[model samples]
Every structure is written in structure tokens, then in C-alpha cells.
Target: MFKLPELDYEYGALSPAISADIMQLHHSKHHQTYVDKLNAALEKYPDLQNQPIEDLLQTLDELPEDIRTAVRNNGGGHYNHSLFWKVMTPGGSQPTTELLGKINQEYGDLETFKSNFTQAALGVFGSGWVWLLPDMSITTTPNQDSPISEGVVPLLGLDVWEHAYYLDYKNVRPDYIKAWWGVVNWSKVSELAQKS
Candidate 1:
């Protein structure tokens, strides 16, 4: 069974950008529910135990039809949220030389890339995510859906789900998106970018 992963930093570490209350609730509550439901769904299928989250996503079509949707929803939530926690830090970090250079080549400058990414995030009318792919492309996915389901590994992703920011920023998604940049784990992004 999958478990909710512990964060590298304290819940209060991302203050101002993201409140401690929001982080605690989001991680302990919302994320925990996903893990619980995922384990319950997989309980009947002993053969599926201990599979890597990515492999489970990729092979969803091959799972028993009865439990496929549960796995897709909760498992995707688990996977996405796991990545989300890792790609954030207390004060954020500077982008590595190679990652910044790649962004410059692809989008002309860092600010331009950020503008496009933010716009993509805002374009999500409902709950979804905006991702920065390894190739420097930006994309969005609805609900807990991930680019990895289609075999595309994203280098970074921003959750636009209301639960992610409603308490702190209320209905102002743009404000949340803007503040999120300050806590982004750019060094982790750099590592993912280079790995792909």
C-alpha cells in the first residue's frame, strides 16, 4: 500500500508564499485521502501491490476494468502530490546554469517563459495543473491527470486546484500562481531537466 510521503521542510517553511495552515491541511488531509483510497482499491488485486506509481499510470489499460478508474484518480493524485511537495522549498533555490540556459534558448528569456507558464495555469478554468516539460514546453492537465499517463514526464508542475490555494488566496488564482514562483524548487527542476 502507498503512504503519504513526508515533506523535506516543515509545513511553515513556505510562509507568505503558502501558508502553514494550508500546507498542513492539503498534505495531511487531501493527500492522505488519496493514499488511503488508492490502497483500498488495490487491496483486491494482490498482483498489483508495490508497483511504482509511474508504471501503474502507464499500464492503467491493463488493470482490471472494475478498479482502473479508482487507481487512475487516487493514484494520479498520489503521484502528482508527491512530486509537488518535492519541488518546493523554504526560500526557493536559484536555477542551475544549464536549466536557465535552456529556458533562455527555448523562450527567449526566463521572464517570457514564466509569463507563458502562468498564462497556461490561469487558462485552466477548473481544477487542473500546468506543467513545464523537460523539452521546455508547457502543458496543462485536468483534475489529477498527469502527462506521464501519455508517456511524457514533466519537469515541473503547478497545481491550480482550488483546494491548493482557496484558503490563502481565496478565489484569486492568479495571485496564487504569482506567489508560487517564490517557493519553486528550481534546483530539483534542474535535476529533472538534465535527467530527461
Candidate 2:
């Protein structure tokens, strides 16, 4: 069965950018619902339960039709939220040399990359995610869709879902996006990028 992963820091650690209330609700409530639903969805397919959530998402078409959608939504939620937690830290960290070099090569400079990424996040029509792909490309996926579904690994992801920022930034998504950068765990993102 799937389970919500424990955060590396306290719920209030990401405050100012992401509030303690938002963190508690997002992780313990929202993310936990995803885990519960995903596990419930797989109850009839015990064999599939042992498979990694990433594998399930990557091979959704191969799953039985009866439970495919459930797994896709809930499983994608599981994977996305899991990465979301890890990609952020209390005070944040700088990108490693390799990751910074690639970001510069692909986007000309870090500021340009941030601008592009922020724009992409804003462009998302509704609840979705903006991801930095392994190739250093920026992409957006609607709803719970993950980059793995498109055959690419995500190095970094920003959740633009209303639930992610409504309490803190209200209707100003741009403000939330800007504050979010302050908490990005670049070290973890760089590790993921280098591994890819």
C-alpha cells in the first residue's frame, strides 16, 4: 500500500513562503488522501501493488482498464507530491555546479530560467504542474499528469494548483511563485538532474 512520505523538516519550517497551515493541510490531508485512494485503487490488484508508483505512471496503458484511471490520478498524485516535498527545504540551498552549468547553457542565465519557469507556471490553465525536465527544458502538465507519462524525468517541479497557494497568496499566483523560489532545495534538484 502507498503511504505519505514524512517531510524532512517541520510543517512550519517553510513558513512565509508556504504557511504551517498550508503545509499541514497539503501534506497530512491532501497528500494523505492521494495515498489512501491509490492504495484502495490497487486493493484488487495485489500483484500491481508491489510495483513502484513511477512504473505504474509510466506504463498506465498496460494496466487493466477497470483500475487504470484510479491509479493514474491517485498514483500520479502520490508521485508528484512525494517529489514536491523533497524538492523543497526550510531555507533552501543553491544548485550544484553541474546543475547550474546546464541551466545556464539551456536558458542563458539563472534569472532567465526563473522567468521562463514562472511564466510557464502562470500559463497553466488550471490545477497542474510546471516541471524542469532532464534535458533542461521547461514543461507543464495538466492536473495530476506527470512528466514520466511523456517519457521524461523531472528535475524540478512547481505545483501551481490553487491548493498550493490559495491560503497564502490568495489570487496572486505570481506572488506565490516568487516566494516559492526562496524555498527550493536546489541540492536535491541538482542530484536528480545529475542522476538523469
Candidate 3:
């Protein structure tokens, strides 16, 4: 069963970019719910432990009908949030030489990368995520669905669910997105990409 990891930083660490109230609820309440549901779903299918996650995903349609949506929603939620935590930090280091060079090559410059990622994030019609993914690549995804499901390794992600920002940023989501870069742990992303 999947569980929420202990946060590496304090709830208040991302402030004044993201408020303490927002971090507390997002991590303790919201992400915890996903972890709980994922545990329940896994308990319902004891035989799945030996399978690769990709194989299990492919067989999801064949599972007993009652557990399908639970597995999809909770399982996906667990997976996405785990990646999200690893990619975030209190305040991040600037990208290293190799990562910066790649960013420049791929998006022309850092400003363009932020602009494009922000636009794509805001373009999501509802509750979702804005991701910076890797697969000899950088890209985005929507909702709790993983970029890994499409063969891309995730380097960074931003939760776009209103619950993630409404109490702090109110309705000015773009401002929240702009503020997020300040707390983004680029070194974590570079490490993940290097592994990929």
C-alpha cells in the first residue's frame, strides 16, 4: 500500500510564496486522502504486488468491475503526489549548468520556458496539474494522470487544483504560478532527469 511520505520541509517553508494554511491542508488533508484510498484499493487486489505498475495498469480494465475506478483514481493519485513531493522544496537552487543548457536549448530561454509552462497550466480547464516532464524531453500533463503513463519521466509538477491555492492566492492563480518558481527545487528535477 502507498503512503504519504513525511514532508522534508516544514509547512511554512514555502511562504510567502505559498501560505502555511495552504501547505498544511494540501499535504495533510488532500494528499493523505489519496494515500488512504490507494491503500484500500491495493488491499482489494492482493495479487497485484508482483506485477509492474505498467502491467497492472494495462490489466485494470480486466479487474473486478467494482474496483476499477477506485484503483484508477486512488492509484493515480498516489503516484502523482509522490512525484510532486519529491520535486518540490522550501526554496530551490538555480538550475545547474547541464540543466540550464538543456532548458535554453529546448525553450530558447528560461523566461520562455516559464511563460509556456504557465500558459499550459492555466489552459487546463479544471482540477489538474502542470508538469515539467522528462523523456529526452520537457512537457506538461493534466489532472492526476501521470506523465510516466505516456513514457515521460516527471521532473517537476504543480498542483492546479483550486484547493491548492484558493485560500492563499484567492482567484489569482497566475500569481500563484509565478510565485511557485521561487520554491521549485530544480536540483531535485535535475537529479530525476539524470536518473532517467
**How much is 123 displaced in model 1, in angstroms?**
0.3
Task: Give candidate 1 regions above 4 Å deviation.
Answer: none
Our tally of clashes for model 1 stands at 0
CA lDDT, candidate 3, residue 120: 82
Give the per-residue lDDT of model 1 (tens digit) for 62-156.
99999899999999999999999989998889899999999999999989999999999999989989999988999999999998899888889
Tens digits of per-residue lDDT for model 3 on 173-193? 899898987888888888877
lDDT of every predicted structure (CA atoms): 0.93, 0.93, 0.76
Stretch of 10 with least lDDT, candidate 2: 148-157
> Judged by lDDT against the true structure, how good is candidate 2?
0.93
List TM-score per model, in order. Answer: 0.98, 0.98, 0.89
TM-score attained by model 2:
0.98
Q: In model 2, which regions exceed 4 Å deviation?
A: none
Candidate 1, after superposition: displacement of residue 190 in Å?
A: 0.4
* Pairwise TM-score winner, candidates 1 and 3: 1
